[model samples]
Target chain A: MPKIVDHEERRAEIVAATMRVIERLGLDGATVREIAQEAGLSRSVLAHYFTNKAQILVTAHQTAFAAVRDRIAAQRAEIGDPVELLRVALEEAVPVDARRMLEANIDVAFWEFARHDPELRAIRLDSHLQAVEMWESMARDVQAAGSARDGIDVEAFGVETQLVIDGTSLQAVLFPEAMPPERQLAVVATHLRRVLRQ
Target chain B: MPKIVDHEERRAEIVAATMRVIERLGLDGATVREIAQEAGLSRSVLAHYFTNKAQILVTAHQTAFAAVRDRIAAQRAEIGDPVELLRVALEEAVPVDARRMLEANIDVAFWEFARHDPELRAIRLDSHLQAVEMWESMARDVQAAGSARDGIDVEAFGVETQLVIDGTSLQAVLFPEAMPPERQLAVVATHLRRVLRQ
Candidate 1:
């Protein structure tokens, strides 16, 4: 039989390497040379999959998020209580573990780029808006289940929760010593109670 | 006197130009070449003022923070109430105005770099620790004045406040349309009340 190659798997490998390179070296230092070295592929071979650094970063972001998305999906399936699921759903977004620490680092690294590039900004903004909408849906489910107070605006709840979550992740990535995973979790949990009471 | 230039003043001007460029093009895009163009000077002239891009970034961060530091100090001097001062102190760190928006952009742009470099990481960490300490001191004053409930962990209060403050700035810089000055103020104000009651 002739040799068979899986294009998608190779691309996924390159994206994972890009993320690892980004995690080890900040986005500023994640050169194509470095990413190719991290991926154990020649520059020419890497280009066969990704044309440039920008494309690789975009793919890395999309793929890195899938981990958190899958975790949240699993939580939604296994948990029975809306409030409890909300907590776990949020925990997945935060940097409470090694996997998430990489994700959060990758997430923040992209923000400055988004500020400069319109395409990246659109992708980032769409992702955050979707995240907020998802949280709002969860908040609505919580309220409908009688866990949250009446008259709460689920949209506002979603926005604030997303802000706090982002804030917590930023804090953890920048100052991991002071903002341990436990403390990050506490901040989100406290936010849940404060918003739920409103 | 022979022709003389104030070295400190010239350095300050370069730092300002660095901020403008970083705010517009982001740290990744804010090459020394772009910064020189923004400053209306040749790269050689820029080299006379600073050694490299790394030094420019460090100086820009330090100087940009001075604006916030000055605002917080003025608020402290003007306000007689502790809780109110706490609110304004937190506000100075957030990106509520054009000036602070620039500061916020510069601030978040540094996070990924700090993650990769040890010296940068230490500088960033120390600044945050100092900020948290500043908040804790302010919280103590609030508690002593009886504005806040007794027995709250003032240290934890400071840490969480700083996290939210940073989180708000990160959000506003990335998505200004969603987090306006009014809404940012509301988030900080709400956090103040929630922590105080605890």
Candidate 2:
């Protein structure tokens, strides 16, 4: 191995560049050339990594989901309490960083493509499933921690939380002034507390 | 006067057809020819009503919003409780009829176009503003009814509700199995109950 670079880490770097292109130029302008330019690599090198633009978008989404999942899991370990964990995990998805904002932009871009592109649709569905599963785990953990009320449907609750988080992300993106981070987090926390069976 | 038909009603009918065309075909597919064909009218006649496709999409969105507003306003007379009235109004946006589905499809189509079209972006921003205003009205009603809790930011609450509704609509379209009508309503109720001060 010349440098012994981590394949996964390099892939993530390229994906992050793809997101920057999306944020600056919408999906219409996120061409392979532009993405490669943003990534500081030649189109040939980018092509070597990803066969096409769709593959690049899909890979970026996969990497974003993995990042989110790992971030939440790590938080789960740090915060042993269910309510606190739920609040923290939910807030993590909000676009608090350039990376999260990039994730949101890429997500919105792919959604339009999903309507007409089967490959994009499959990737979007898989991402949603992964999110739901992660939330499901969080819900179960909350219930087990004794913070949630008895008779709570962890699966259903997980779905509900996912809906709110997803919805909040969209709103924050569209109307950042109105849905500031503090306000979004507060609204989410209040709603989450109420969903508990108590 | 050749019968002097209700211009507003006829315009709405045409806009409704616009939504149907968008639902069947993607935004790019919903051209003047297609809409005119669907509306059972000549392209010239459609042009007389709306100068271009942009105007048609805007009018269709207006018509959809009007239907939602009228439904909620009408419910206001029969229902005095703010929470219950808001609940019913929110549920009305869910996919209860083909019309609602068509409206949602049109929204998604326009959103896709908005990424590339400035006029459509303005329309979307206007729609979001109108929604916020409508929610503020509902929030005020809740407070006036003495059901709202103290220190609740009505505007923020309104924005959050809109986010949930928007999110629900997206989910209903993308993952019908996961976000059915009954489940969506339950989540709406959960949010309402949680945020209400009383």
Q: Which has the greatest DockQ? A: 1
* Candidate 2 local lDDT, B34-107, one digit each (tens): 98899898989888887776777677777777777788789988997888888788788666466676667667
The alpha-carbon RMSD over the true interface for every model, in angstroms, is 1.4, 1.7
Residue B164 CA displacement from its true place in model 1, Å: 1.6
Model 1 over residues B27-103: C-alpha lDDT tens digits? 67778888888889898988887666667667767777667777788888899999889887877778888878877
Interface DockQ per candidate = 0.62, 0.55
User: Which tens-of-lDDT digit does each residue in A1-198 have in candidate 2?
Assistant: 634466666677887887677778866687889989998989888887877767767776776778888998898789877778878888788776667866776677667767778778877887887788878887887777677776777777778777877777776666566667777778677667654654
Cα error, residue A190 of model 1, in Å, equals: 1.6
Shift of residue B60 alpha carbon in model 1, Å:
1.7
TM-score for each prediction? 0.83, 0.85
lDDT of 2: 0.76
